[model samples]
Target: MNNTHRQIAVIGGGLSGICSAYFLAAKGYEVAVIERRAHAAEEATFGNSGLLAPGAAMPLTLPGAFATFAGRFQEEPRVLLASGADFKRNRWMRQTRQAQQQRFAANKLRLTRLSAYGQELTRQLQEHYAMEHENSSGVFHLFRTPLEAARMASLQEGAQQCEVKHKTLDTAEIRLLEPAFSSEAALAGALYYPDDIAGNCVLFAKQMRNAAQELGVSFHFSSTVKSIQPEFGGRVALELESPHLDSRLTTDGVVLAAGMQTAELLRPLDTPLPMRALQSYSALVPVKNPDDAPNMALFDDSYKVAMTRLGNRIRITGLLGFMPPSQAIPPKALRNLLKIAGDYYPNAANYNQAHFWSSTIPILPNGMPLFGPTRHGNVFVNVGHGVTGWAAAVGSARVLADMVAGEKSAVDTEGFLPQDLAA
Candidate 1:
């Protein structure tokens, strides 16, 4: 490994930071990853839906987004509702409303470019790091109602404009793909994205961390970043506070990938970012009969449930809405999730021994994440990816790495500037 003196500090050891550090290390930059947790990806990144579905790339601020959200509001759990007093919700709503008009169309174009770029980056990592995480199984979207099925079919028109590969399947066709789904409420038809795949997010992060370490990148797990100060000559210093230590490190460059806890650190620097948290639930269940389980990952759009088969365990994760970070995962939300899962795939798994979990998704109101360098010299951000963090992390990391290394990017990042706002 080349011994480079240009040390770079990365805050947050989740998928975003790990991928950023790994890519920079690959380019011969000395990298240090400071994480608040005892292990990497212990937060939202640990148990994500794990879809590499770039085809699902659509801005959250679409023209009909409000209608879609309103229609499904009653069916969603109470904990998902945003509290009026929450500072994050207030900020997020302002930004979301601002993004509704012509601004949303521009955001969609940016997301399409970024997400497609992200998918390419993931493919590169699978080859570059030689890591295995149950990837390659395609993704399926099952529709319980004809109306829901029609909505998916309409989405295909937009998908075609982006050149995303997908297929529509009828009831018998879906059954042939997964025999376990025999319920009367079983989806009438489905939309399949062959390019989409699943994997263990935590395992992927661990493997990438290992690869980075092999190339001399340092990881300081459990080291919480206290503050960041802009220093002289285009550099920044990071203050770290943790149970066992208090220290500081100076770097030529810094990337803020901190999920929900990013606003405060940016506030001190006068680079306030619009971000919020949307909590979601997931359950891990062991398969009753291995053959009955679906080989391809499934996303039931109507019920908002997505299922992924991870070796011996089936990970069913979905149901999104706004919530405070400190609140515990609601019991009703968990029960509702299990009910939906059973309705979709009755024979796929036995929920008796399932383990329930919940985590927050860092969100920007428009559903587009802010990436690239901030106005402050040498400070960059790659957070607020919402539900697509794991899917988009590697690609965003690659773009940042290229920026840091003074190389040209394959994707155009014109709309991804750190502080760009819509009118």
Candidate 2:
């Protein structure tokens, strides 16, 4: 299939959409990305923990997970959930219930394959195009107790099946690897994934967008698509409005990667995409003493929080809300993050000047992203990546572009079909 004449429109400008445009443009297609923000990565692509660990793509619906999280959400102030009613949220809860241990394992395995594929593509992009994102490798999954070590059981199995390299480290070994863990509280064992990486997804997306622009991919910033409808000859048309322009647009193919608004985008086409939004919070506390800060990415599994060192700042990201979009950060949530930071790496950052951020992530109950065709073969989706969006961006784009170009994808497309989680 010669894609030289195709004009592809991507309905988002975040990591997933930019990566999609990058690949499509690389393949000689006329690509255009429509972003509502003034710049790229201003939404879900911003403020993530920045760890690109394929080993971290575990499913949230493990056996007894619902019970555990139900109790945890009720007991732990950091573990958040909404009691309000949302049609999609309620349906998603039921689907999560159906995705017991068997489905959880299946989803995790699928995610592992996609993660491996995406990591390689990400590496290639960085090496080939000179993309910058504060690149670094090695992440520590710290376990403070034997019970925490036990929780790593299933993830370790999946990592082995994926043939990823890792090392199990004891307390002394962990301290040697990262002295900030020298505190008595940091004692237990941990699994160190050597290939896990950390980088600014927003920076990577901006650089990739520049590369795409050089390849003649048009980007329309501050443009929001009002509606999408199927035109004659199997084309999808977009009615867009912006502060500067209100117009109609059409393309040979459309890829929905618009983050939280993706389901709304597809609704006009009557595509029943089963995804609910989870508003997440994070804080970027400036490093007051960089010399004392831990350089390796850290994941406190017990608290379900992650901390990463990004240059002179400590990026602490965690906390999940089962509700829709909002910028308001709960005081209790911020306090919880501050506590985590202070406990593990005391005096490493200046909490007084910490920067807070919030964004919505689209989650499917099955914990796998949606890919391939929607109601129409020409319409594809690459949303529902959740936290793995940063790691899986490039590979998802590569696969989406291939499918749109009538070529086979690089990863297995079995569980990635459109509306696979619409149960």
Candidate 3:
């Protein structure tokens, strides 16, 4: 991989694209990140529920997850919302159901592997840059129901096998760990992962982008990519709608990291992919009493919610968020989120003044991010990350850059190859 004058164009300046730019620049390649937004991390990466939990990287589509999803939708309509008839014909949903029934274990194993690798890569960036994402170590996955407690506790075995350090904490142990949680709460038990950490994902992306720019990476803001076409010897170029730029821009290579929009760009190249945007709701509440807040992160398996203390603010997120990207999240959706947050940490934050947000994370049916080169050779995709985008973006981008530079990847990217997902 001679990097004398090699250049690459990365679409989407979110976490994935910035990471690709950072890694490519580190490898001494001229990289340009063409972003549709005015700033980086202003999209899905902006308000992500920040958890680097490789110990629980399993997809939502477990063996019986479909039943749970269906029941949640029935019990609480706001938990999963569908706005159009197009949802019925969603190939990603259909394939997710099929894969859950057949390849559940395989999917979990692959995600776990990539997530673990990503966690390590993230630590390097933190050490090098002295990151300030409000990183707090250890996460408690609390269970309220007896069945769910037992079911989630079973993951302890797999975590051990994968060498992810963890602990099964009892009522007293959890109390000592984080005394902010109410003892009257109906938590049956908890699985504590000491290695897991929560941080501000948006800050991380912004810092990474700044670092890349410091190393000679260029960024194009408020730019829209119209099309991508293959050129001579399998190279690719992009057509843009910009004021101060040429309508068409040529690049030695391209990595599509624009969330669900990646599928649109690939469609023009006859490589249409199944990528769905699972909208997620997040709230940022200012903490009134920092001492009373849960210093550690908390994940409620039954409710599908997570709460963490980010500096003086508390962030809580829940729901599967299955709706059109353009659809505004109904104001009523906050009821469930408020209920769950109050049930766990009532006095930790001021929810009345909470800032509500919605983000659409790109997801594939199998719950694995698409990585590596495409059939066009010079085109690589780094989308379909879903909720794990924050956790795995850097590692995936590092490997993607390596592949673009014609070098062996630091992580095994076999199961997530483009042809591997072709059905």
TM per candidate: 0.87, 0.91, 0.91
Distance from true position, residue 161, model 1, in Å?
4.2
Candidate 2 C-alpha error for residue 421, in Å: 2.3
Question: In candidate 3, what are the lDDT values of residues 187-212, reduced to their tens digit?
Answer: 87788988888888888888998899
Which model scores highest in TM-score? Answer: 3
Best by lDDT: 3
Clashes of each: 0, 0, 0
Can you tell me which runs of candidate 3 are displaced by over 4 Å? 1-5, 60-78, 83-91, 144-154, 187-189, 326-328
- Residue-level lDDT for 381 in candidate 2: 86
> What's the ranking of the predictions by TM-score, best on top?
3, 2, 1
| Per-residue alpha-carbon lDDT of candidate 1 for residues 125-235, written as tens digits (9 for 90 to 100) | 778778786875677777666654655644576567667788887767666766766546556677877887777878888888898899888888778888899887666
How close to the true structure is residue 46 of candidate 3, measured as C-alpha lDDT? 72
Q: Please, what is the whole-model Cα lDDT of each candidate in the order they appear? A: 0.72, 0.75, 0.77
> What is the descending lDDT order?
3, 2, 1
| Model 1 poorest ten-residue lDDT run | 60-69
Clashes of 1: 0
For model 1, what is the alpha-carbon lDDT of residue 141?
A: 72
